[model samples]
Target: MDFKLEFGITDEGKLILADEISPDTCRFWDTKTGKKLDKDRFRRDLGSVEEAYQEVLFRLLGIN
Candidate 1:
């Protein structure tokens, strides 16, 4: 699991996280099958984009 972050500078010279984290911003793969479970499916025309996103959600929420 790898993710990206965006930062912004506030008027008071504070650096704050400026991006929403989601599957679109990260890469995930199945540990056993090495299948991609991120946005790559959409970009690469791999199909099952929705299912991949749902799988990620289920895994994150500890669902079966």
Candidate 2:
């Protein structure tokens, strides 16, 4: 998975750090096999929506 870090300021005047801010930051896997799925492949085989969603999930998980 492609990973990235972001820094920002919080409402409380504190520093906030975030990992994986967008799609293409992680790889999806089969729940049973734990095998990672290629997002590009999914996009080519499926559609843009699925790929975008998967990438968002990975980014939220902070997977590197």
lDDT accuracy of residue 52 in candidate 2? 56
Model 2 earns a TM-score of: 0.30
Clashes of each: 0, 0
TM-score each candidate: 0.87, 0.30
> What lDDT score goes with residue 57 in model 2?
63
Candidate 1 displacement at residue 56 in angstroms: 0.7
Give per-residue CA lDDT, model 1, range 1-64, as digits (tens): 8999999999999999999888899999998999999989888988798999999899989999
Query: What tens digits encode model 2's per-residue C-alpha lDDT throughout 1-64?
Result: 5455778988898988866544455555556665445565565665565655765567568964
RMSD of each: 1.1, 7.3
Minimal lDDT window, size 10, model 1: 41-50
